[model samples]
Target: MTTKMREEIDEIPAAAARLLDTQTDLIRDCANALKKADPKTVVTIARGSSDHAAYFLKYAVELQLGLPVASLGPSLASIYEAPLKLGHAAAFAVSQSGASPDIVAMARGARAGGATTISLVNTIASPLAETADFAVDIMAGPEIAVAATKSFVNSIVAGLAIIAAWSEDKALVQAVDALPEHLQSALALDWSALLEPLREAESLYMLGRGPALAIAAEAALKCKETCELHAEAYSSAEVLHGPVSIVGRDFPVVAFAARDRAEASVAQTISKLAAGNAACFITSDKATGGEKLPFIATGHPITDALALIVPYYGFIESLSRARGFNPDKPVALKKVTETQ
Candidate 1:
């Protein structure tokens, strides 16, 4: 990254991350949408890294809120792939720049089919934001890094806040307000010890399960975009399905175990891979001071949204430095990606 982008990332710790002043209003508005509408169905539209966060939101919405959630990939909604209304019930499209034509095209189709549209995006005047019936800005502010480290975390939290507001869960709403700060704390972490290890890697895998899987997916994406390395993401449970076959000593795995429910399963998965001679690193809140920590502390459940993402931001920064890649501007990617 250039000096300014690096300074901005480093400066994340200096400023206190806060809640959206409009989040309560957003909650009230989304609550109206849900109160007068169907909680039975919802659809998400996004692309690239935004799509991964959408996947995370979809799973969390379905599992936690009991809403049947479906994620609409941009390609599926594109004119080239198909012509269709993605979901007739309710639709929420999450994007950072909010100008992706594919997402806008899909939003039009959803609106045409009588679905209430909500656009959760960063820029208030963004095209996709303007196209929707309702819009909520993630409030992440101008993200200079093209890899989108902060916006992804903020989008998921905003999605969670919207769901929480509609569900009338005050705890989750409060949790969203607390999350950006929790992330600020994690972003302040000193990863100086991990430099030697990161430099020694031939390939890396960042794996997690449940809600943390969203973090793992983006971590891999960040690694690839920033370092041009062969980094991959796997659901901690899904890692056992077949990918474990390729385990070797040279492979390094960054395993995230943040949730109480899937934490044990992810731990067992980490152990399984470690026993196979894979070098493993763990991120958790329970590390003892005397022991060498493969860990980072995190706020759980709702705040886990940001807690999971902050360290990956650190990892991408380190990867960029390690490989001499500039995190500020990716070689071929633009601030607003418009893929056909």
Candidate 2:
């Protein structure tokens, strides 16, 4: 039987297309507002999968716009009641449900701190949207899977669109427009080679650099939430510093490498780990001894990083089924986590 997770994974390309088609005006409007604010810093507020999307956008904003971005802990506003000094800053908040009290509180705090607040949420009617100065509804549409698939992808896409518009990067704008086609191709990628090792493994490490590090984190989370596998995500550079101590024989390591500046370093790390007898797999073909998993290149760094997750979502869903767990109803998880 096909799972809800698989169905939502298949919907990703269409969902991305629909988001671009429907939210272009909102994205442009938010970009115009951001341009006028000319904030020197960008602050992001989120948690869980939404936070991973924030990590992805942090790199894009810093790289393209040359403005440093930081993620603000929701507890700062929710628990500590601390005030942020963000007068010369902008905030991007992402929540699928938009009902989390902490998330909503932080967005309000950002706005009160004089940041131009923008929210990307699936539920436009929720409090987080109302708290922000601008809200772009990421039309992911009725995600039934407890583990977010399309919404997570669209959240990143929506943020990228706004950044594209703000920076007026013609190439990134074209790349964003062309992502549906790349996403369609991404679904066909077969990562079945990873199944045998991951299914039997007790724990694994997922590594990436730059924006792809966020994808690695999302992939690692799905493995635990869906398959009950123990996984941790780390940057390709940081993995060798401390985490590489666990890289003994047959230890599984999945390294995500996009066609960007960090690719060579990631490949080098994967190769070194593979040489140490770790069951290392990498997305790029440039690595030595590491198994090559197929990936689609979107010709832009940000989109290329986003595309890596499509096949990974597919892989983890099947891995979940193979491990005799329901990917849709992960034990202890609900579709909408109303965290305060």
Best by lDDT: 2
Error of 1 at 266 (Å): 0.4
* C-alpha lDDT of all candidate models, in order: 0.71, 0.94
On a 0 to 1 TM-score scale, where does candidate 2 land against the true structure? 0.99
Model 2 agreement with the true structure over 61-180: per-residue lDDT tens digits: 999999999999999999999999899999999999999999999999999999999999999999999999999999999999999999999999999999999999999999999998
Tens digits of per-residue lDDT for model 1 on 1-340?
A: 2544565565443222433554667757876886687646888888778888787888667766687877766666566556655344778888888888889878766777677888878888988888888888877777777887667766777777777777777777677667655666676666555456667666777787767777788878877777777788898878888888887777777776775577767777777777777777766543221112233344456456447566557756776777777877779777888765
CA lDDT for candidate 1 = 0.71
Runs with alpha carbons beyond 4 Å of true place in candidate 2: none
Distance (Å) between predicted and true CA of 300, model 1?
Answer: 3.4
- Each model's RMSD to truth, in Å? 3.0, 0.7
| Model 1 spans with C-alpha error above 4 angstroms | 10-19, 80-88, 285-299
Specify the poorest-scoring 10-residue window by lDDT in model 1.
Answer: 286-295
lDDT of 2 at 24: 90
